[model samples]
Target: MNNTEFQAARNRPGVERQSFKKRLSDAKFLLILFAPAMVFYILFEYLPMFGLVIAFKDYNAFKGVWASEWVGFKYFSYFFQNPDFLVLLKNTLLLGFYSILFGFPAPILLALLMNELRSIFFKRFVQTVSYLPHFISNVIMVSMIIMFLSPTSGMINQIVQWFGGDPIYFLSKPEYFRTIYVTSGIWQGVGWGTIIYLAALSSIDPHLYEAAEIDGAGRWKKMWHITLPGIVPVMFILLILNVGSLMSTSFEKVYLLYNPLVYSTADIFSTYTYRVGLLQGNFSYSTAIGMFNGITSFLLLYAANFAAKKIKQVSLW
Candidate 1:
């Protein structure tokens, strides 16, 4: 029956609601469609959370997870009191803050500019060139950055020397590390990031722009009045996702780019955890650090969602 007929049948004096089995049979196709994603998350995400017990245990490979001796919060307290705690926290927060400050708006601006482009050929070419960098592996990306900024034969240093300036080792200096990392990240991902905003832009009703034009509005006015409002929800959702990861810096890129010389500014929680946990085999200590990072990220996500809901009435929820 159609929805109206179904409702009419339900409203009849002796009619009864459908059984759970009937509902399940009716939704079987959708259930089948959702099965793969449910299975994937169960296997790779939720199932692995059981390993978190190691954060409170003195984990031993020989004893396995459950058999490991209970250490309570020993590792967590040790990390809090460690000499590198403050520095690592500072570096991680600064990198994340700077990335959001600069990196977040980059794709929005690019999407807006691309939307305004009159020539499809030129726009496609620009997008193609921009997206190429994102597909480059992290190892290759870091290697390129190192080579391009090398003091001896690097392109940037060579240009500086040609202008009668000294060759500076960019990656070796602590002060320059964050800038290089954040800027390179923006360049690498901005184009790929624009794809979502562009999709959002396309979904905006074209009639809004037409109506604005009919009222003697120009390109900028249409964008300001219609285009931006249409995409504000998408932007806020992405912002919330970014804030959730504020404490989780890219381990692969940072590990590849940083050395002892730049560790003062480049060492973050993820890299520190890797060294202590995997390299040094201090499993319990590493697990504690990871747990702390995860907890902080969860709190940030909650706070951001709360603030966004209050301020803009837009949130992940």
Candidate 2:
């Protein structure tokens, strides 16, 4: 084709789409590699989302989704009006709040401490020991908690006996539920969480520390001025994510550990949904509650991202 024909082709109405198709063809190999993941998400993640419409409908399995009677937020209203709603909401919020208040900082502190260690062997050992617990399955972790907290034959009780104090029933007590859950969660996750911060710390230029030293800055001063600031962007980005997940608690841990005695403080949206939806077969009610939880999480995430972008010029977006 000559210049006139080339210009006509470029200015064609479908030129952009044709160009996009050409690009896709050129990247066909990459797309082939990515097809499995794309298919998996479409089949599992996105397709299941369509089922969420049951939240607004009565959702009779026999009636089929399309044929279900539209209740139009009836289940949502029911969930809100339920007598246990307030208690469940409070319990869920407190557990999540305690986790953020305690769990989020534990890793940051550990990462900083690990960074200060001059001995590579000792640092690796500490990291290995700390992260090993994260691999322990929730079932095993809960069992360990139960065994440790047992009033009889437990090491904790033996310690109490040695100290001439009564053996405390930790898991059975509603007041201790939040404390145990948050503490155990921190133990399991803190080391793994430090991975991101450690990566950020390594990216800091060694020159910054050397300059601080030349200025007669002490260890603490150097860390405060240089090291911390180097990772502030990463920290704020992570903080935004954590704040967004403030409504979500460890459902598996809570479900495994909680009983009727500790339900006052241990119940959460997931466990509640599991019982009411899966066990009792109240699909609509459970779907509404789950949807509510997801919406709140999204809103919280947006708020946190907005705040971080405004305050620190850092955000996930």
Candidate 1: tens digits of C-alpha lDDT, residues 41-60: 99998998888899999898
Per-residue lDDT tens digits of candidate 2, residues 269-302? Answer: 9999999999999998999999999899899999
**Against the true structure, candidate 1 has what lDDT?**
0.93
TM-score of the candidate numbered 1?
0.91
TM-score of each: 0.91, 0.91
**Cα lDDT, all candidates:** 0.93, 0.91
* TM-score of model 2 vs. true structure: 0.91
Q: What is the lDDT, from 0 to 100, of the residue 172 in candidate 2?
A: 85
Candidate 1 scores a C-alpha RMSD against the true structure in Å of 3.2
Residue pairs in candidate 2 whose N, alpha carbon or C atoms collide under 3 angstroms: none
